[model samples]
Target: PAGRFGAKTGGRAGSKPGRPGAAPGARSGGQGGRPKPPGAKAFGRERFGQDLGPVRAPKPKRAGRPADEIDVHNPEGVRLQKIMALAGVASRRVCEEMILDGRVEVDGNIVTELGVRVDPEQVAIHVDGIRLQLNEHLKYYVFNKPRGVVSTMEDPEGRRCISDFLKNKDKSERLFHVGRLDAETEGLLLLTNDGELTNRLTHPSYEVPKTYLVQVRGPMAQGVGAQMKEGIELEDGLAQVDSFKLVDSTPGHILVEVVLHSGRNRVVRRLFDAVGHPVERLVRTQVGPIRIGDQRQGSIRVLGRQEVGHLLASVGL
Candidate 1:
């Protein structure tokens, strides 16, 4: 008789004792019965009866900030991208791309991750290897100073000066000229509220270069350029041009360009005068990286971001 132990008396060899006609040690809720626990080491069988290896708990999701996120250096300060955009590096979106591309550096470290925060006044930021000016209050400009205008912001004699052209500016800004161009000299001049940069630029140690276009009585002597390059004895000290080139030559006037690192007063006029070709008309064309290209006379233009960066770099700022 078949009992609850599955026909123990007449069960076939190796048959389990679960139920009548049970085959080969089969149990009610064993391998072919209930679903296995997720952590079970038991092999699973696919619908097609293919053997599937032990089920593994889905790899615990990695715990931490994602790769794209950066640790905020200054939680309360402005975002790096925002500051970069304000500093005129580019549009906000473009600045983000630049940061991700690793073209930006904060305090000398290449910053690739986004969401970085910094105090514009505290940290030194650079883009494309050029120092960025982050101070919104510090203004820089290139004024196309016309002839007979004194370089002083205000002249005591009441002559036309830089201040006349700056009447439209905010009175509280307190901007000052970086260096100076004499009353008779005309062309590019830098005006800024950045005192440290101004001092370094004007200092003799930095040797910030200045370029000028000089119109002199023509038929210049053969060795004038060479002699100027060699050195010219000025009332103050020896002065020399870093570069000199004859641009145009006519019957009575010769147009020449000279570049020098001397910031001495009236140095260009004195150099040509010493060489026997007194400057008939003098126009300063460049100061460091800033240029007066096509800028109309007596007009003021804000210095571009790249120009300011280059100017800062020229004096090792």
Candidate 2:
């Protein structure tokens, strides 16, 4: 193989003088030196629009942070218990129990952690294998409860109750009375399935005032309004009217408007009873910013958006 080109080509195999087939400096087909490291050729393959074999295995996931720790800066979702309650599944406390009991599912997987957040708008939720209908389209109504109607949905005593009125009304979603008026009392009562609004309205810290129009036996006492305004200590606690105004007056009966913020059972009747003017007829005229507004007795109507908004705003909801 020692030839004229071999001396000038040096020791390298491809450094020989050029010629057909076996040129001294020319290499054919075979690449020189060592091969590339595995998968290194795939680099820039995507840039050239070539198939670089199956894409390189995904980069290994980083490991450092604890799994149990939640990132407060970026929350995953709404709390499972809260969203369930909002969906009218149950009360918040009951929802928590349902979750702990392993009767709740998210995205077809059973989720028992109460802390787990779920995107209610995106995820499918179920309870006890039954799909839950989210109360996304919340409903708020003003029902003018008539006399002899119990405030509750059902009574073991088999008395007439709010369910009777709701029987003919809309049944799209479960609705609850925000507050109660006894069977003998009647007027504007709020009915809604909006858990947040209901919570804020019913919470004691909000001090949402309720107004009542009462027909009571009067004309004997002159300073009755002042006495009721001060306060009347009941067995449970101090019950007081925020303001008292006389709407009409007669010897036999007088119509007065009483405003109070207490939610104690039958507090209104107790207040009038303490004042020595027994209430002949008690009708709740308003709660917060909502009023009966001449809605005939036993008639139910959906509240206007503005009315609902104002009612919520009054309680800082």
Candidate 3:
């Protein structure tokens, strides 16, 4: 009698019942006739009448990496913000904000995620479109070298040298002068622990332009700037300045700005000497993108990130 009644009710024999003509083994509610397992976790929204808390929007998907960009992901590498902070880009917090603001890029892909990791040595990183120098060991400085100071790090003759101005710096890291200025010449001299950058900056083939403020005796000269630009013959060979302009002229002395890409020994002095205007005082004001500005003589200042970036970019680094 029970089996025949089950067929009339559309339920399996001995099944619990409420609805007549319901499908066999189907539950009255939406539980599909199966009980939840013991100790099973329940989601908040799944429990009816519970508060769902604040709803969060999904994050936008990142764009695909360019075809030219290599994969920079490194599971064991340091975090992106940590690397940026270590590279002197900014504090870790600020770097995180910069990353979120889309101002940072790794291997040409704009990285906005703070959790991204990168190998500092293998990846190319840029912040605000400026290449970042990631090597912590490398140091760059602009030294306002004083007159009579030898360009060498140490002078054997006991004269003032570049090292004398850097007594407070870490003695372990050897800093090399990018280029030399004779004992009599002075101005902005680059000091760096990066050997590759030093070589590139000093190598004559790179043609990194240097600007100098030259004081020379000038009374009668009509075409001196043009003559120097045209090319002046010296002892070694013909030398020329990229541009020459007279800045100021007094009774017996004149201040001239000379820009040239030559790294020849005393090239500026020799060029002025060839034209009968011996250099009274020679001070290099600029080297590539770095400048002396108002930096006092015999003092050193570390190069800023943007300055270092421009300096490296100038040499195709």
Clashing pairs in 2: 15-25, 16-24, 16-25, 17-25
lDDT of 2 by residue, 191-225 (tens): 99888888888889999999999998767588888
Give the deviation of candidate 3 from the true structure as CA RMSD.
14.6
Order of candidate numbers by lDDT, starting with the best: 1, 3, 2
* lDDT (tens digit, per residue) of candidate 1 on 1-317: 23433433434323444566655534432444544566765343322133455567774532444433544367767889999988778899999889888899888878876667888898888888899988888899899999999988778899999888885654467888888888899999898899999899989899888899999998887998899999978889899999999999999999999999988889899988898888899999999888899999999999888898988888877
Off by over 4 Å in 2: 1-136, 167-169
Once model 3 is optimally superposed onto the true structure by TM-score, how far is the C-alpha of residue 309 displaced, in angstroms?
A: 1.4
Residues 1-317 of candidate 3 have per-residue lDDT tens digits of 22332333333333445467666545444334434345443312233223234445566756645322435667778888998898788899999889888998888888877777888988878888778887778899888888888888767889988877776654457888888889898889888998989999988888999999999886847998899999978889989999988899899888999899999999998998888988889999999988899999888888988799889878867
Clash pairs for candidate 1 = 16-25
- Whole-structure CA lDDT of model 1: 0.81
For model 3, what is the alpha-carbon lDDT of residue 7? 34
TM-score-wise, the better of 1 and 2 is 1
TM-scores for all candidates: the values are 0.75, 0.57, 0.71
Count steric clashes of candidate 2: 4
How many clashes does each candidate structure show, in the order listed? Answer: 1, 4, 0
Candidate 3 structure lDDT: 0.80
- In order, the Cα lDDT scores of the candidates are 0.81, 0.74, 0.80
